[model samples]
Target: MAGRLRVVGVRVERVSGRVAVVVSLGYDGAVVTGRADRATGETQTIQVAAEAVLEAIRQVAPGQTRWGLEQVAIQPMLGGPAVVAHILLEAEGTSEHLIGSALGRSGPLEEAAAEAVLDAVERRLGWFTKN
Candidate 1:
């Protein structure tokens, strides 16, 4: 929140054996991947640094109050650098029901996931650019 509000598209993908939420951060708007679990029509997203995505988790799973960051990476994007924060969940039975409601339904999971993450960031840091 110290800097200007950065907007980058987000993409979420469930690959071979990992669930990743890619985002474009301050660095280069890189892909910030995180592990996810989908079951019973519910999705639970876990990431390192509970504070980073605490808002999203809580929003989806009100009971979720803890998390940790698995990996943090920064990659290059088209115009600017991308920042990717790979997070790890603490529990195994995490839910995925909060996907649509919490994360926006405009794009992929990564984008929605990014919205969730940013939602927390804005709450903690305050709106980057207020109208």
Candidate 2:
């Protein structure tokens, strides 16, 4: 586990009291689910891809600069109108090295994982690009 906390992207849907639901979009197209305890500030996230790890990084980068890769696309749900919802996660008890260790291979895996998380975030958050 490294000193710096690792930032991962999780589709935070609902937060009631001390509990919240977070879903991680893996690079292999898998949904890793978890329960976050706000009171204790502990997140027991499921096993996700390197992309998810990158998403976490983007969430808490150094400055205004765009973290990870550009062009995050989040598609809306079909056949229904959904209200925009955002879940703010306080990153603690996790680091990049810790996440990287779980992600297996470094370099490309990290980049791809980041991209995947961003895509999920964009879709979940309804982020759109101006053409």
Candidate 3:
């Protein structure tokens, strides 16, 4: 079996009052990066990070499935906040589906954002073992 794709890093920054997130993933010896933008608001960093991770995954595995984010929730953690993301993924040809969720936390907002995305990607990839 092929090795799984895993999120390696995430970077979040504020630009013109908006949030910009970049997500990096590693599979085998290849590295891929995905970017996303979001307006400043509650949990904006987390949202942008998640979107970037999803986008990167799509780029790496275009035929996997179409994904829709269902929910994102944040709770207090020891360092800062813990983000929980729920996503719905639908198969391309059939009606097969899967729900994936992940958790991330960090003292820094940007790192936390990236960690959340990494967690989500790990969980989502578990549903599709082929890639």
Candidate 4:
């Protein structure tokens, strides 16, 4: 097994109802980012986005991990409604980065983003397990 993965930072941004999330890991300088569109325009978009991001992190690096969320940013975007997410991850002990993205509504967007991020990380680290 490799060394444990740690989350060093997190950022959540919201514009008008769309959300963008970034998760940074300490090992190998990995960073994962995602976005979502809220159909209900709920006020808890940040929390939701954070959950999605964390879930993504959990999927990629599953055992004996540390979470060090550092930052979160939220704002309004002046544009139409759209949902999209992207992630750039560098697994520990490796130099190459894994990138992924997803597009859809809020619920699907979250799942898609998480899947994309995890898929990239798993491809490199093979640390995740089904749950």
The top-ranked prediction according to TM-score is: 3
- For every model shown, the clashing-pair count is 28, 10, 0, 3
Task: State the C-alpha lDDT per candidate.
Answer: 0.37, 0.31, 0.65, 0.43
Better of 1 and 3 by lDDT: 3
Between candidates 1 and 4, the one scoring higher on lDDT is: 4
Q: List the residue pairs that clash in candidate 4.
A: 14-75, 15-76, 15-77
Expressed as tens digits, the lDDT of each residue in 1-131 for candidate 2 is: 11223233444333443433343433223333333334324432221232244444444343332423222222233532212212232223321211111121332232333344443344322221111
Please provide TM-scores, in order, for all candidate models, with all chains considered together.
Answer: 0.33, 0.22, 0.72, 0.32
- Compute the lDDT for candidate 1: 0.37
Q: What are the per-residue Cα lDDT tens digits for candidate 4 across 23-129?
A: 55443455454333354465345445544565546545555543222222232234422333333433344345444333334443334434334344544454433
What are the root-mean-square deviations of the candidates from the true structure over C-alphas? Answer: 12.8, 14.8, 3.4, 11.6
Model 3 deviation from native, Cα RMSD in Å: 3.4
On TM-score, the stronger of 1 and 4 is: 1
Model 4, C-alpha of 36: deviation from truth (Å): 4.2
| Candidate 1 structure quality by residue, lDDT tens digits, 23-61 | 344423333222333332333332322223443333333
**Candidates arranged by TM-score, highest first:** 3, 1, 4, 2
What is the alpha-carbon lDDT of model 2 when measured against the actual structure?
0.31
